[model samples]
Target: MADGRVERGNQTRRAVLARTVDIASVDGLEGLSLGKIATDLGLSKSGVFALFGSKEDLQIATVRAARAVFVERVVQPVQDEPAGLAKVWRLCESWLGYSGRRVFPGGCFFYSVSAEFDSRPGPVHDEIARIRGDWARYIERLLDEARLAGGFREAADPADVRQLAFEVMAMMELANAHSVLHGEAMDYERAARGILTRLRAATAAPEELPERPPAFDFTAGRPSA
Candidate 1:
């Protein structure tokens, strides 16, 4: 009986987080309320509240859950590839694929929430900022590894890698924003082209990359979120 109760509680927590992440993506973290969530999912209000304790707690948990999904959908797939300029391309391509596929209703989960809580100083803002920073660092790390491996220019140092990573990420975020706001898929193609151009310019091994970016999925219509 105790085991069954624990399992049920675990399932409920997962269910709540799953709903919260999607809702937060579309409506922003501030849009979430335990009462509304419970009502929407047909769960007891008291039980939902008990699981999350407070609104802030629920938002934080939602961010964490979304991060897990992001890793599974984007980061892990290219993780085993040999570290080089090609791997860098693979990472960007994976990220574009995730956004292109509309893994979340609102597009990139962090992109939506970051705009909402960027100026607000709170636990939620801090959590989002931390994760965003981690992503930047990871990209820089990949670029530096490529440089060390002779895939990128040997003259490029940490600073250059940092700048390159920022530019690359900027292109991607623009694509995500354009897709979410304009409901057009052209930005994905634009981002891919921009990414390839930048990588090709930065690489020491010209033959390591393709002459052009692979085709992006352009069939997705405007996002409802």
Candidate 2:
């Protein structure tokens, strides 16, 4: 009986988390109230609270759930591919797809929460920072691998590539925000093109770059102060 109850509890927890992530992505993490989640899932307030003792716990769990979803839908697909340029391509395509497909109703979960919580210091903010740093490091490592292979110029710095990767991600997030606001997919396509163009330029030998549509340069960053 105890085991059965525990199993049921675990199932309920997962269901709540899955739904919570989607809600938190579309609505800010603070907007993810127990009342709203329970209403969405037809679960009782007490039941939701039982799973997560407090809103902070729920926020942390939601972040973890979103990360798992991202890894499954975005990272795992690329991991199976051989490392170097191919892996980097796969990774980029997967990331764009992950955002474009709306795995969460609002686009990228991290993008939503990071902006919401970046300036606010707390456990939730800390989690967002850690996730962002982890992703940047992952991109840096991938860039390092591609550079070690014949994919990138020996003169290219991994840090520069990482910065480029961050720019691409920022572009996607900016596009997503504008799309959500204006109800159009053009920005998503534009962001994808921007990413691919920079990636090809960075990775391909100068002689090997194919003629394609012109790319936007987000790596230009903020204007000099």
Candidate 3:
């Protein structure tokens, strides 16, 4: 009987965090309120407060929950792939898909919330910065792996790899912004093309890179693969 009660409590907490992440993505973490979330979820405000204790605790939990979603959608999908240029490429594509698919109504949760808290000093800011740093290091590690596999040109430097990762990230964010503003999917195609072109240039064996269609056909209501 005690185990059942614990399981139910865990489920309620998960549900709360799921809704909290979506709300935080759209309105920024500063906008979150336990009463508002409780009302939205049709639960008692006191119950929600019991779960999180405070708004800051709720925000922290929301960030952690969103990070778990990110890992499941972007990182785990490509984890088993050959760890080299192909795996790196898969990571980029997965990220694009995650944003384009609207995993969060406001788009990339981290991207949206990071901008909100970047200049502020607090536990929330520190946590978001740590998440961003971890992602950057993951990209760098993938690039290093590709270099070790001889996929990149001998002239490629570690610094160059870092720059490329930054460029790819920029393209992803740009696409997210444009798509959200204009409601157009073509932005993703443009981003993908830019990433593919950059990767091809650095590739030691360009032929090993995935083939793209001759042109993107937006009239068909879907971009060419």
* Higher-ranked by lDDT: 1 or 3: 1
Worst 10 residues of 2 by lDDT: 216-225
Candidate 2 residue pairs in clash (backbone atoms < 3 Å):
none
Number of the top-ranking candidate, with lDDT as the measure: 1
State TM-scores per candidate: 0.95, 0.85, 0.92
Whole-model lDDT per candidate: 0.90, 0.76, 0.84
Clash pairs, model 3 backbone: none
**Candidate 1 segments exceeding 4 Å error:** 218-225
Scored by lDDT, model 2 comes in at 0.76
lDDT of 2 by residue, 44-134 (tens): 9999999999999999999988999999888887786655655665576667667766778888889899989989999989988998889
| lDDT score for candidate 3 against the true structure | 0.84
lDDT of 1: 0.90
